[model samples]
Target: MILTLTPNPSVDRTIAVATLTRGVVQRATDSRMDPGGKGINVSRALAVNGTDTVAVLPVGGPQGQVMEDLLRAIALPVETVRISQAIRANVGIVEPDGTTTKVNEQGPRMSADEVAALLAAVDRAAAQGLEWLIGCGSLPPGLDGSFYADLVRRGHAVGAKVAIDSSGAPMAAAVAAGPDLIKPNDEELEELVGRRLATLGDVVEACRTLIAGGVGCVVVSLGGKGAVLVTADQVAHARATITDPLSTVGAGDSLLAGYLHALTHGADPATALRTGVAFGSAAVCLPGTEVPTPADVAKIDVEVVDPVDLDLPL
Candidate 1:
């Protein structure tokens, strides 16, 4: 089973319109509300695909109730830690041209006792035959970046492979803890390394440096340019077949879910990359933070290419 810890989860509401004019009223074209935050999205996608998984998070107040209700409606298993402060409800406005404007609320502030309870919940979840523990998304106020670092250590102590998807100081600290895997988009990758990764080789070298520092593996997502995977033994590239996209939210989380699902089932490096990118590509064709199901992933054509051009422009 895969376990996920979303320290700050949300209820995402996405509205669609013909165009977004700054000072003018607009009529809606469509709308949706889904469970948000990176780790929660991954668990949602995994549950849809019949993968055994559970999401552990902090929830409180009415907004938190709504978030929990949404997850239950989708049958995503959750182990919620009750917090004193309410979580957030984030909004997104999507245009017909796939332009997205998002406003995210600063989620709840947890007390010291609440933080300890949250970690204890994750520890309990990890004890239940969990294979991977994914710690993701931005840290809420009052929690230091070391939160993820501590979580990684706990997961490792339980023999679970920890994969982190976060940014800034939180990401830096987690990487230093030597996570089993990390999925950093181009911007996050550049930010973590403090350099301009203008080429595929530059990205590869950056990931290699992390591996040398004890990180097990790194996956650098290049948006439309596809994704690259770097390990101590191999560096490979995989690109997805493009499609008319509706929204880009939750695509990266879907990629991580697919890759982990395949990996735990013994798929090779290239095959895992293919599945990961396929799921991500499929997610872009859906609305809101919708995750791609197996059918959606099956329709996407992606394969990790050999003789990966190290100098490929990102």
Candidate 2:
């Protein structure tokens, strides 16, 4: 089974309008709400794709209850640690032209005890024999960036592969812990490497640097251009065939879910990259943060190719 941890969860409110005009009254054509968190998104995508997965997150206040109810309605397995602070709510304004503007909250503050309790839950989940442990999203306030690193260490000790999708100090610390896999988009990677990635060669080099830092593999997402997979043995680029534009949000999470699902199911890195690219493309073809179904992924053509010999800064 795949286990995902989301320290900061939220209730996502998506309002659809014809256009977003500042200082003007607007009416929303439609509205939808769902559980919103990186790991939560991954778990939902996995469950929808028929993967056995469970989401572990901290839930508090009325909004937290709403998040839990939404998860239950979808039949997704969730284990929430009750907290004192109310979970945050994110607002997304989607225009008719597919432009999405988002306003996000910083989420609730997590105390030491609450953070400990969440870690305990992760330990319990790991003890239950997890195939993949996904530590994703931002660290809640008052929690150290070493949180994901600790989870990676625990997951490795239990013989479960860990995949991390986070940014900033948490991501840097987790990389040093040597997670089995990391899925960072181009911008995040650039920040980690402290350099400008202007070309595919630059991205490949940055990925290799991360791999050299002890990460087993690195998947650098390149938006609509697809993603790059760098392993100890080879580097491969997977590109998605875009059909139509829908919503780009949560596409990266879908890609990570697909890749993790494939890796845990015994697919090679190349195959996993292809599947991830396809899944991400499918996600972009759907509205809002809704992940694509397996059938939708099957229709996208993902091309994988070997990169030419490139110079390395090492």
Candidate 3:
């Protein structure tokens, strides 16, 4: 089973409108609320695909209650740490053309005791054993950046591979600890290496640098251009075309989930990349943070090639 920990989970409310005009009244055409956080999304995607997975997160307040209700509605297995402060709620405004404007809360300021409780909760849940322990999402207020890095060491101690999907200082710290896998989008990759990546070569070079630093593998998602997989001795690029695209939220998480699902099922890295691209591509055709199931992904086709063309523009 795959275990996922989301440091800052949320009730993500997505409102769809024809056009977003500032200083004007607008009525939403549709809206949806989903459990939000990178790791939670990974678990949700996996669960829908018939994969064994568990989600671990902290919860509090009315919004936290809503989060729990949503997870229950989806029949997702979750282990929640009760925190004193309420969890965050995020808002996304999506236009018909697939333009999304987001307003995210900073999340509650967690106490030191609350932080310890969360760590303890993860330990308790992981005691049952898992194949992969994933630490993902942004650091909530008052949480240390080294949190995921600490999880990496803990996962290794328990004989489980660790994967991280986060950004900023927290991600940097986790990378220093050498996680088994990391799924960073092109922009996040640029932020980590502190440079602009204009071509596929730049992404490969940057991923190689991370592999040299002890990271087992790097998966870089390039949005519509597709994704790249880089390891110590392998490089592959995979892409899928999406017609009638809707929302991009949680697509990357679905990609990571697909890759992990395939890898755990004994698929090779290249095949896993193709599977990931298919899942992500399918996700884009759905609305409001919705994840696709096997039926939805099965219709998608992914083209994967090793020895990627470095000259390809990102």
Candidate 4:
């Protein structure tokens, strides 16, 4: 079983509009509300695919209640830590061609006691014998970059492998803690490495540096350019052709879910990378933040390349 912890969860409302103008009233073509945050998205995708997973997050106020109701409506297993303030509600505006403009709130400031309670909740969940503990999403106000680093230590103490999907200081600190895996998009990867990674070789070298620093593995998601996976012993690049996509939001989360799902089921790193790309490609074909089911993933074909073309521009 895998346990996911979302530091700043939200009620994500996505609106499909013909066009978005800065100062004009517009009618939405479609809309949807899903449980938001990286870890929550991963858990939701896993549960949809019949994986044993639990989502742990902080919920409070009316928005928090709505978030809880939505999770229950989907029959997702969740463990929520109550906070004093209402969690954030994020908005996404999508066009017909799958271009998304997102407006996200920073979320409420978590007090010292609330932060401790959140970590304690994660510890309790991890103690239930999870195979992996995934710490995801952004930190709420009042939390420092060391938050995910602290979680890595906590997960290791309980004998659970930890994976982190985040950016900025939180990600750097977590890297120093030597997580089992990290899922970062191309932009996030560049930020973490503090350099411009314009080619596939650049990405591999950056990941290798992290591995040298004790990170077990690094998975970099390059939108449309596919994804690259680097370990101490192997490097694989996987991509699937996706045409006329709907939305790109949460695609990376689905990729992480597919990769972990494969790993837990005994697949090798190369096969796992293919599965992740397939899942991500499938997600782009759907609307809003809707996750793809097993059927959706099965229809997509993935290609995994070894000795990747270093000159391929990202």
Candidate 3 C-alpha lDDT tens digits along 1-314 = 99999989999999999999999999999999999998999999999998899999999999999999999999999999888889999998998877788889989888888888888888888888789999989989988889989999999999999999999999999999999999999999999999999999999999999999989999999998899999998999999887778889889999999999899899999899999999999988888889999999998988876567999998
lDDT at 137, model 2 = 91
Clashing pairs in 4: none
Candidate 2: tens digits of C-alpha lDDT, residues 97-179: 66789898989998889988998888777676788999999887878989889989989888898999999999999999999
The C-alpha local distance difference test score for the whole of candidate 1 amounts to: 0.90
Worst 10 residues of 3 by lDDT: 299-308
Cα displacement (angstroms), candidate 4, residue 188, comes to 0.6
- Per-candidate Cα lDDT values, in order, are 0.90, 0.87, 0.92, 0.92
TM-score of each: 0.97, 0.95, 0.98, 0.98
The clash count for each model shown is 0, 0, 0, 0
| Per-residue lDDT value at 80 in model 2 | 84
Better of 1 and 4 by TM-score: 4
lDDT of 4 by residue, 1-314 (tens): 99999989989999999988889899999999988899998998899988899999999989999999999999998889999999999999999889999999999888999988888888777767889999999999889989999989988988899999999999999999999999999899999999999899999999999999989999999999889999999999999988788999999999999999898889999899999998899999988788989999999989877669989988
Q: Which regions of candidate 4 deviate over 4 angstroms? A: none
